[model samples]
Target: MSRRIRVPFVLLLLVVAAVAPVGGAAATGSSDAGTVDVAGTADLDGTADADVTPDTAAGIATNHGGTIVRTTTFSLTPGEPGSVDATMRFDLPDGVPELTVGPFPDGVTVVDEGGFDREGDRYVRRDHGRAALTLRFDLPSEQLSTADVGIDTGDWAYVRVPYVPTEWSYYGDAPAFRGDAAVDGEGAVQGEWAYLGATETTTRSAGDLTVRYVRAAGDPDAPSPDAVFAGWNWLATRLGSGGRDRVTVFALPTPDAMEWRRSPGLASDEDGAAYVFSRAPATGTEPAWFHEFVHLLQGPEPSEGMEWYPEASATYYARLAALNLGASEYGTFREASTVEEPRNVRFTRRSSWRSPTDYRQGALALGAIDATVGAASDGDRRLADAHRRLRDDDRLTYDSFRDAAVAAGNGSAGAEADRVVDAPARHEFVDDGLAYADHAPDRDLDGDGLDLATEREHGTNPFLADTDGDGLDDPAELDRGSDPLAATRDADGNDDGEGSADEPDPKTVDSDGDGLSDVRERELGTDRKRADTDHDGLADGEEVEGVTDPLDPDTDGDDLGDGEERESGTDPLAEDTDGDGLPDGHEVHVGTDPADPDTDGDGVPDGEQHREESESDGEDVPTWSPRGVGEMVGDLVEDALELPRMVADVVRLLT
Candidate 1:
């Protein structure tokens, strides 16, 4: 029902709101008095007093020259059976500012509300709207909001404060989304991110960089926050700098209901913060955690044509970071280079970019530019420096990238950049201070099954190694026809098996389990989402297992599907299993055994048994001519007279 996700993650709608300031400056430490206590505050009745000194920790906290606001708190409680009771509280310091709200997500409606009227798709706020307005919305497990990651499974609730549309809640001259979003009992929401139970927290740090990991307690098979922190550490070290001193990682267990292909994970690059949706383990998108970390160090969206740059850098550097951390191999990296896009596709036309289809293209091109810049500076300058320069550049474009490269002392990179920005052409790419060498193209350096020849075919770096801590190496995976990149899943749905994925089909881990990816099905002219490409009563996996053509309804051209032929005791390849004149399909249609020559038990073969009737083996009887019928009748009468005469002669002889 949903489209396949080419890139590993979805860069969700980046919230662009006008500056609705709630607090003045940043503060350190926590104050219990103002700690956003929404669940149990019988003293304050229903309203959260805004005049009280803002809880600098949860509401609006200032730190490291940045602002973290939590002026808007959305409290969620377990509801009746498969439902969740949710309430939104906005701390409007200047009273309820002129605002219009409503038309909440499906399955969410307010009861006993009298001040608002519906107009088209929105609820018009009336004059009598109170300061402590409590809009009770029911979030059922069966139905979910469009942009919100709110879930209620009758047992626990994971709620990511829904990003309401600007028009849906038009706050005229009022600070609508002024402060940060926090759960009542869960404390401050990270990047308006996941909140489950009470938001238990932990920390992992390297040097000056610290990653705060959060998740619900007792979540099943939650992803290891330590592993994600390790990924961030590697990327930070490789880049020689971390974007910010501290960031948050909400590690929610991957919900069985959550579809990774539709929406995998998200990151707020401005805050150096991202969340790992796989607190529970998953596959399809290999190294999703690391990729999110890379995004933390990136800047906002660039201008047109260069819009692809942010994604390209993230995709490219993330894989490389995984390799640096011993998570991936050179063969895996090289294989991505081999991925081909349309010839007309170029980095300069990034405005027309699509996920994953163009990501690999830009990645390879960016790699070439990085190599060029690295070579020009004789290892003194690298793309990392240029990247740091661009992180703060408000206006990001190709020219700015060139200027950044020049300032980094790789002036020669502009020429190579020209080649990549336009079209991908052959260019000298330096890796580790030397041009990529294919002295032994057939050599499998790491014995991971992939050879140097395959690596260099993409015209990019062949220097790669599987560093990810999985037992199966890249060479072995490729040699065995298993997925060489991304997390591999075993038959038990665990993440430690050799994969046969078609680039991690976005729908599910081999949704059809047909060993083919969804996109590959499209390219092969098969049903993109159906496991049975030809719908011959056989699954694509079954077809593969039985050594039949999954793409053909009738592999043997017998007008019977391979599955049907098997059921009908006929040979799919022979057109007929038995040595009969009738085809298997025709014999079945005529109710005769295709395996038997004489299906009617006559002295003649089934095919020749009805020879006088018709030339075809159809369900029809031959019609006798009128003269032939009369001749038959006369012979029958003469035989009857002779029988009586013979009987009388026999009786006289016996007497």
Candidate 2:
């Protein structure tokens, strides 16, 4: 019985190149246009059944296994034509598996493939995996030159196999294989071909996958070739030289064709070719591009038991790349994944596996590893070095990866790796690592009390303490319920229903209408909304302009208000003006000039004369006239006697 296993969704979109068979060199001949021809065939049908074991039969038996033969010919001589021919033979030697073939290039004309139903760009052979057929097509030289393939039709072709490689364009695992070759009539020399072992072979996984691009003609919806190249270039630079050098990216016309859940659902070739199903531009901004590109930088997992590492690393780097390229902000990627998932499940445990949750948690684990490595090495090494070690090592396994990490960061990295890998779920250590990767520390770049990450999220300028140029800093603005992103307007512009008539907007100009702007109030350390900040009966603006302390009601401590002192032309900071003994306010209230000690020019001082009169009369008299007190008293008595007689005369007249 054929037992076909469902392919992993991510792997279906990946097309990895075949590692050359043991002792075989990769194809390395250059044509005038740098083009070469490649041909291969895989007979997955039961006719070539070698093993019915659980491992080999799972992919072939359950799924409708079929045979696929393909040939591609192109020139390296810049501006040359190329061609691709594929034959799909189907049958269910045991029973019909749902056999389908060829998401063939767009504009391909079918020639002599009998009894096959055409469905879009693909050829369908149903009710059996048993059949033989051939397909033929032509490729233009200009189309071949660009990095994008299938641009005309918005889809590319792929042959379904039991297991697909993560890289693009490699067909090494095809059941019965024919080597790569040059076209029959082309002047190109036949390139070398090798049948690398199946995906189960961990011994010979060192070599990189070869990539090629194909696209549909005149497809306006396709991403620009330049953008695709730039994105790849950025990814390559990030991964460093040890990463895969050659990759082919096929830009699909629509997103539907690239859906993971659909039929003919392969998004990548066994070789390092990718099928991008986005209608948006293929710039680095697209997270999907980064996600797939990261796969090329990943080395093979150490063992079947450790298969999650590759996927986890890919997931982690996708977000990292986006952040590095400024396509996304810090914490965005982690928030989406780690925030919702359970924190206590072992990532490697089968029962703990959840679609995106597991993926995100695994990424966190990798991030922790990266941080540990970086920290231990004092930034002298990084996670990339560990990956490079994995690529260079002959054995790929969890232990190998751990050893590499430990070596990269000395002994410290090993403990960190264990802490992440063995934990049931995420921990604070993981969060710290993720934060470290994001450069989230105690950094308040603007000294606004908000960290750089928060500043970025709130749209506040990290370099400027006051993002809006408001009188308040960003933190103060937040505390005051003001927008750090918007500048504080003048009083006339403030109508957001926050401040009342009595309390003007502190951020506005002349907030208190005291002739001082909010900026000036801040400079003078006065309340912006209160005309008399210190309740000294003087406007803050006037006090500030007059060089008096707005915060102090009694600037001179002379029993005089700042406003009264200013009105009297007395120094507000000094209690005595013009050597007067009386207080400034007291002198002004008594109708005496505070600036002059003796207004009448008497020999005695004004304060001394007043004191002597009070002592002599035994009364609290503020001032005494120059005439004698006896004359004053006589005038007072005469006025009183006259008032009584006048009253008696009025009473007699009334009677």
Candidate 3:
């Protein structure tokens, strides 16, 4: 397919750069539910009349941070095999106003303060006062025992925690010591603490999960799978963040897929596969992958707002990794090159076969920002340093990362922060005059074009061609042993053809992964690499809707292909197509086939060929043109010469 021209993020980036924020801030506020159910004490004196805004939760009292405080548990009561109450405690700041609380998620009812929101979710009573609010939502153990909660300050920050399904510890004490009876001959405590007791400590550990690549659907084979073990071990080790505690990975069969997650953002399943359809997955080795791993490790509290920063970090670092790996050289076609911008752009846009332009353009914009903005100081924008800091200090946030990036640029964090806050744009450094060809060596070493100033102003690359401006120099791709004409086909792939390359080669056949080569798909009109023709979700020989398969009876086996059914006019997948008692083809050959059932067994379908005959008309039919028949056979008559002399004389007269 022709590449789509990137609609130019330069404008968006530069505009964003002018007003980017100084620091990342969270929206504020929390909701309220009255009293501690277990204690039967009203934390709030009463409902105070006050308007609630996202900025702050009213009537809640807190002891510590000016924001709403939250805590988490590994398991709780509702999660128990047969419990009903799933509860969480919200410690509000002392001077907050009236606030309302509720049972989140669809279909839950709040028994105490009954009211429904526009979306039909339930909300409970409001509390006003100077103490902690203990809100409990009834959850049947049959449903999910655990649910996540968010304590939004409704202003600058929202605290979140996972509410497990078991009773929690209020005393903040260590687990009780267990008696150790079993001892070796040397007399040491044999079984130290068999089970972990109740506590609310966040453990930094590797996720416990496994994944495997299968050949196709219905293939029963498991081998060479990826598994996670040990506390944040290899993942952190690979990220170069030693001693890191937490890490998460959202694994999928491929990075450019759309169907994995229905929506954008991070999702952690029961088995710990954190599926993130929004962010682009890392492609390079070592440090680059580690850079992505860090983002997962951070588990940046999910918010629709803070999505951009993490992605910016990942893209920035990936470029750095490429630089470090000696894979990129900086210059021009014929000089040195640091980035394969076109490939980077192509892969980013087309990845997942969905949302092609948004991600790649966004990533490119960020890379440009890092390079140009970071260039003010002699390599100070220290993008790599920022990533290192993030991995080293797990608590580092978007604001902190931005600060590091600014420091590298020899700029004030406050100034850049304001820029970010005002405009969410990024800028790129480019010398537009020179055109770059596919696989062409970089030419401009000093980022200055010897070409015309107009070309430089336009940042135009003369070498870029093709009508739609897909950014590929069609002639160039063809020169480098690739098909320049077709959008899909290209050479350079494996025999199995299971994985598609960032670029596909077409000259050779066999794309379908079916042992057959491209020559076959061309002959059969099937995708050269894939054997399925007509795209009816089945291979050609297997089934064609209008065609039949002789080998398989029931022509269309309910479970068979159309080709199988088409061998005869009936659907192979179905027992019969016409609904006749007899099979289809039998009607054509079986003198009395049920396909055209008629009790009379007549040649016509009974009534169509009625037994009536036209009555003989009384009028005589005129017969003429004896001469026409005679003229036609006069030559034969002459050859036979059986006619008398008078006949011969008549024939001669006519001739």
Candidate 4:
């Protein structure tokens, strides 16, 4: 079975904090409920809203460099095996309008808000003054098994500490957590983070990047830390990003019962760290790593309004980077980007974290933007330039990103982006940029005269000389008034009217019912529609089967019918088969042996005899020689007399 689990940060927090019941619901015991309490003092000086400059527009905040020190503890009582108790304690800045905390994890029931009221998932603090607040909730312990937070399994405790952001701002640094964390009254010490689910923690440095791998004790099949570092370095180089100072990757065992958190999984934090869980070892070439690395390179989310860009960019670049690194092929990325998904909703309006369709649509839109940029700039710019600009920009928003793209590309690229990204419906764009990046437009794969780009433009197969598998090549078909798209045609070059039924393919079969197949006709340079290409007296089948030329009516040019020559047992190619002065046809008409040069044992040749007879009569008397005339006269005399003795004597004399 295969499962895909998307554990978005905001969603995870909501699930964690909202499990407590509102009123009078019995508190499920700690065993059944997984309780996590997070306490942190507000660093008001580092608030993103306070850090915003005058030039920043309303509702926009600046980056907050200061960190909040948070301590989150999970406690579960022994009574209920699956329940949990969760409490969140944090201080709000003085003069702030309101303090909001969660969109917490599900299965969390909010039982108490410490005098604060609930507005959506957050505990509303309307006092607008400096104060400490605590919100309590109950959640199912099973949820902890999937959550990146530490899990306590009685004998061992495992936890993934992620920087959970408060709901009030988008630009604050990830809160720092205490190294010494506890679960169920047992103290837990920080262990090195694993790389790709290895049993031991291994660290390696390459260039400016440092990578850490953490694995459980028994699993020894995880990838080596050095290998992981090398892979990361390769990716970084290809992506054109300087290496980060530190990147921690956790390789955890594949959760058995949690189908929601199966292998082939990757989730990253605001800090340059990731938790990758899979049934198999992690490789840098995997799409999971490529995707997460894209996130790392993108840094943190810059603004709430631009929530969709990071994931979208990550999804799009994962495939692109894979292609560049030779980890994937063009067809793979093309297929992924061009998949048909429902486009009823705008890509930006769709939830980036929860919906896969939004990612796909956004990737497709980015592909279109990239192609447009590359085309308009003549290779001067691409989608990566926009991403680089976005990474460097302090105030990031959709408009800012769009402007960056426009600056990198031309006006047409901006228009393309608007058409694909800002439109109400998602549109799929061609991946020609990726497909033909390394080739010229005129490169022909099948050696058909038409280039690949032209073939694509004309809706013909670039890999095939004849796209429809017709007897004619694509260029020939185009030149000779044939439809390259249709394989079947009638005698007049119209569709064969077979509709959906199985009919003979014109490319493979002789549609005109001619003796020659279509391929043979093409090879012979004969008319496929007409059996006798030269309009000869003989049928094409007879001419071909009899070793005669179908393109020429008289192959021998002997003034004799080829068929007649065959009947007379004479060579059709020879004018006179017997080397006689008379032609084979003339000899046959004259009732002389064509193979014999002389007849009646006469010293003169048959041709001489025929010529003498013709000259004597001043006409063409080929069979009227003196001997033949005397024999004919004697036969007439015998018949007239009807006298047996005289007829016998004349016949003997004539013989």
- Which candidate ranks first by lDDT, i.e. highest? 1
All candidates: TM-score: 0.50, 0.41, 0.28, 0.44
**C-alpha lDDT (0 to 100) for residue 99 of candidate 3:** 29
**Local distance difference test, per candidate?**
0.51, 0.48, 0.30, 0.50
Rank ordering of all candidates by TM-score, starting from the highest: 1, 4, 2, 3
lDDT of 2 by residue, 1-655 (tens): 0011222121121222442222111111001111112222221221211222122323332322223333333222122224345343333332222234455444455565555666665555544334544554454322321212322121232221211111111122222222232332222211221111111111111234333434444556665554445445555554542435555544433534333222211223123444444354443322566566666555443453365665676667666656544555444544654545356656544344545554566777777778667656544567766777776654467678789888888775776676567546554223321223334345665456888667644445554677555466778666756656445553456532334322235445564589987666656655454588666788887877777888777778787888778677888887878675777766766666787887656555668766665343343335544345666786577567657655875674333
Candidate 3 lDDT (Cα, whole model)? 0.30
Highest-TM-score candidate: 1
Residues 327-414, model 3: lDDT tens digits:
3333321132223343222112112122322333334444544443333442323344444455445344446656655754545333
- How many clashes show up in model 4? 43
Model 4, span 209-273: residue lDDT tens:
66665655564545555544554665554344422466666554544554533334444433355
Model 3 residue 455 lDDT?
24
Weakest ten-residue segment in model 4 by summed lDDT: 24-33
- Position 202, candidate 1: lDDT: 76
Stretches off by above 4 angstroms in model 2 are 1-85, 88-215, 238-245, 255-269, 280-286, 427-655
Output candidate 2 Cα RMSD: 32.9
